[model samples]
Target: MPEHIDKLSISVVVPVYNGGKTIGRAIEHLLRQSLPPAEIIVVDDGSTDQTANILRSFGSRITALSKANGGPASARNEGVRVANGSLIAFTDSDCFPEEDWLKELVKGFHSLEIGGVGGTVRAASGGLIGEYVDLHGWMNPQCARDGSVLYLVTANACFRSDLLFQVNLFDERFRKAGGEDTELSVRLRSFGYEFVFVESAIVRHLHRRTIRDYLKNIANHGEGQFILETLWPQQRWKANRRKEIVRSAAGLGTMLRFYRSYRRQYDRKRAFVFSLLDHCQYMARIWGYLRGKRELSSSSLRNPLTRDPSAVVYPNENLGSSSVLVPKV
Candidate 1:
C-alpha cells in the first residue's frame, strides 16, 4: 500500500445507469484531481447500455459493483458499504470536476464538526441550458462565503463517511431521480450538522440539453417532492413550509431578473418568455407537492402500507431501470 493508505483520505461514489456516453470522462476527471481519492467506486444500477462494458474496461483502477435495477439511492448505499475512506465525495457521471475539486473539498474539513461541503456548478454547454445556469451565477464565489451555506448541492458535495452511515444514505423511496439530495440535506440540518460552501471547487454540470428538456426536469422535481413528503410525514409540516415559501419567492425573483437582463443582451423576447414559463412550471410542481401532501394526510387509508379503504397497490418491480435517463448532473 502507498503512504496515503494510512490516512485513507476520501472515497468518491458515483452511481451510474445508462451513462456510457459520459461516465468515462467523469472518471478520468476524478483520476486527475490534485488530491486523488484513496478509493473510487462506481455502482452500476442494472445498466443495459455500454456503461457496464466501459466500467469493466477500467480494470482495477475503480471498484465496480452491480445489482438488479434499484434507484440511485440504493446504488449509493452499496458504494458506501465498501468505501475505505473517512470522507465520501459524490458527483454524477454527467458532471466534470475542476482539477482542484478534491483538494478544495478536503480543505473544508478543517474542523471535525464540518460534516458536509458543496462547490459551485456551471453548465457544460453554451446553449439554453448554459444560459439558465449562468442566470444563477450568484452560486459562484460571489454568493458563497467559503465558511458555511444554507444548502449544499449533491452533484458536487462531500460528506463525512461516518456521518453518512448515521443518516442511513438517501431515502430509497424517492424512486424518481430528484429531491433525494434536498431531503437528505434538510434532515442533516435538523440533526445539527453544518455544511460549508467551498466556492473555489467548481463542477461543470451538464443539465437539460435543451429548453423542452428543462421544463420536463422541472416537472420531475414536483413528483419527487410529493414522494419525499409521503415518506417523511413530520418533516412535511414543520420547517419545510417556511423553506418552501422562501425558495418559491427567491426562484420567481431570480427568473424575472434574469429574463430582463437576457432580453436586453440578446434581441430575443422569446427567450425571456421561455424563462418565465420555466419558473411557472416550477410553481405548478410545488402546488402538486402541496396537493399530494394534503391528500396523504387526510386519507391514511390510502397509504399502500396500510390495508384499508384505498388499498393502494405497491409496485414490486424496482422503480429505477436502465431505460430511464437521469438528468445530466
Candidate 2:
C-alpha cells in the first residue's frame, strides 16, 4: 500500500498559459483538496495576459515559475525539475479533480510493481453535445492491469518520479497539443511497466464546448500521430497501418452484423443508411491520418517558442503552442 501520505509524496504540476479566465478557479479547487499536494507547481509558460497577475494572486500557496513561451511539454518539464515529491502527478489548468483525487491515487499504489497509473475522466459539460460525447465514453476508465496502445489519456495521469525519467519526459517535439502523452505511455508499456487503471481516482475534464473545438481537437490528434511517426518511424507507420486496417475492418464487420440483426427484425433500408454513415466517418478519420502524415513531413517541425521573433506572433494566447491545459493541483 502507498505508505501513508508522507510530508509530500506527490508533486502536482499544472502548466498554465493564457489561463487568465479560469485558472484561478482551478487553483482554488486544488487548495481545497482533501489531500492537498505537497506542492502545487504551476508553470506559466510565458503568458502575455492577466494569467501572470492571477498567478501572483495565489501568493506562496503555490510555486509559480515563468519561462519563455515553451510549449506545455516544456512547461511541464520545468515543473518536473523543481518538483520535490516522490510521485509526480499532472492535471491541466482547465480540469478539476475530485476532493479525494490524491487519496485515491494513493490507493492505486497498493501494488509496488505499478510504475504509473491513470484515473477516470468525466466530461464537465451539461450541454447536449457534451452529454453525447460523455456517453460515448470519452473519460470512461478502462480497467486494465497493464496499458495497451488503445488506453492512453494524459489529462488525468500520474507517474512515479523515477519512471518518468526512464521514459525521458513528454516529447516536446509535439508543439501542437496532442499525442506526446500516448507515445510516452506506449513506450513505457513496451518496457514492461504496468499502467494500472484506477477507477476511484476520478478527474473531470472540461472538454471543448463546441463542434469547432471538437474538430480542432481531432485535427490535433492527427498532427500528434504525425509527430509520433517521426520518432518511431518504421514502427509507428506499421503499427498505425495495422490499426487502421484492423479497426476499419472491425468497424465494417460490426456494422454489417448490426445491419443483419436489424434486417431480421425491422427495416433493412434504415440499417443500411446508419451503417453507411458509420463507415464513412471511420474512413474519414483514416484518410485524415494519411493526410496528416504528408502534412507533418512539410511542417517546419521546429518549436517556435525556443526560437526567435516568431514567438511574439501570439503573445496574448497563453495556450501552449503544444500543450493542452488540464486542471492542476
Candidate 3:
C-alpha cells in the first residue's frame, strides 16, 4: 500500500433492498476486511422483509438508514450523502468481498488523476445460471482498448468521495441498478478522469439462480442502455431496423456455435438448453429496450442533460422522515 493510502479514509457503502437473505453475510465479510474501512454504511431501500431487523441486529457496527422504496441509485445516493470517508467503496448487498478486497481496491489509486478503481466479481456459488453468467462475463467491468476501465460495476468499485459529489453522486432518474453506474462513469470520463481495473481485488457475488431472474436482469440492462442513449443522443448508435432483423437471424448460427462449444464441458442436452437460453437473453434485452423507449416517451421526466451536476440536490440530503441510526462507537 502507498503512504497516501493511510491518509485516505475509506468508507464502504452498501445499498440493499429485500436483501434479508444475504445482507447479514455481506456485512460480516465487510467487517472482517483486512484493511478495515473508517465506516460501513448500509442503506435499506425500504425493504419489506426482515432486512431491517437484520440491519438492526448489527447494532453499532454499521450506520443504518431507512428510506422509502427508491431504487438502488437513490439508495446509493443517500449513502453517499452521509458517508464520512474521503473514498467511497460500493458493493451490492448480495456480494461478499475477500478479506483483502479493500486493500487491493485502494492500491489502484496510485495517481491523483485516477477517479475510481474497480475489481472483479466471481460467482459465490455454483448453479446453472451462475455458470452461464460467469461464462458470459456479464458482471465484469468494461474496459477500453488501452486497458483503462470504461465503466466500473458498482458491485465491486471504489471512487474518490469528492469526485462522486462533483458528478452529483448518481442520477436519480436511473431508478434501476444497471445503468446508473455506467452513466456516472461516462460523466466522470467526460471531465477527463480515468478509472483503473484492479484484477486482484475480488468479490464473490450471489448470482440470480433462476432463468426468470437472469432474464429480468438482462432486460433491465437493455432499459439502462436506452436511458444512456437518451442522456447522450450523440452517443446513440444508429438503429437500423432491417440490419437488426438480419443480425437476429444470424444469431441463430452463433447460438449453434455456442452449443458446440458448451458440449465440450456439458452433456448434449444441457449444452443445447444453455445455447437456447443465450438466444432468449438477447430477445429479453430487445423487449426491455422497447419497453424503456415506451416508458420514457410516455412519462414526464425531464431531460437529464438539463440538470446541472454541481447544483443537483439528492433526496436523502434532507432526511425528512427517514430513520437514521448513527454507528455506535
Instruction: Give the clash count for each candidate.
Output: 0, 9, 0
Model 3 C-alpha RMSD vs. true structure (Å) is 7.2
Off by over 4 Å in 3: 1-3, 238-246, 249-254, 264-266, 298-329
Residue 320 CA error for candidate 2 (Å)? 35
Q: Quantify all predictions' global Cα lDDT against the true fold.
A: 0.69, 0.66, 0.82
Instruction: Give the range where candidate 2 is weakest over 10 consecutive residues by summed lDDT.
Output: 311-320
- Locate the minimum summed-lDDT window of 10 residues in model 3: 318-327
Assess every candidate by TM-score: 0.75, 0.73, 0.88
Q: In candidate 2, list every pair of residues with a backbone clash.
A: 17-318, 18-318, 91-327, 92-326, 92-327, 93-326, 95-327, 175-322, 177-322
lDDT by residue for model 3 (1-329), tens: 44555577799999999999999999999999999999999999999999999999999999999999879999999999999887899999999999999999989888666879999889999877777777766677887787778899999999888777666788877787778888888877776778988989999999988888888988888788788878866446566853663465357886887799889999987798788777777787777778889887634334553256344422222112212112111
Q: For candidate 1, lDDT tens digit of each residue in 1-329?
A: 23322353789999998999999999999999998898889999999999998999999999999988787778888898898777788888888999999888777775544668888888877676566556666234222355446556667888777656555667665555666777777655655667877778888877777566665666566766776566546435468665765475457676776577667766566567556755666566666566555554534322312112332222212111112111111
Which number leads on lDDT? 3
Instruction: List model 2 lDDT by residue over 116-158, tens digit each.
Output: 7788788765654455455456555344444442444666777
Best by the TM-score measure? 3
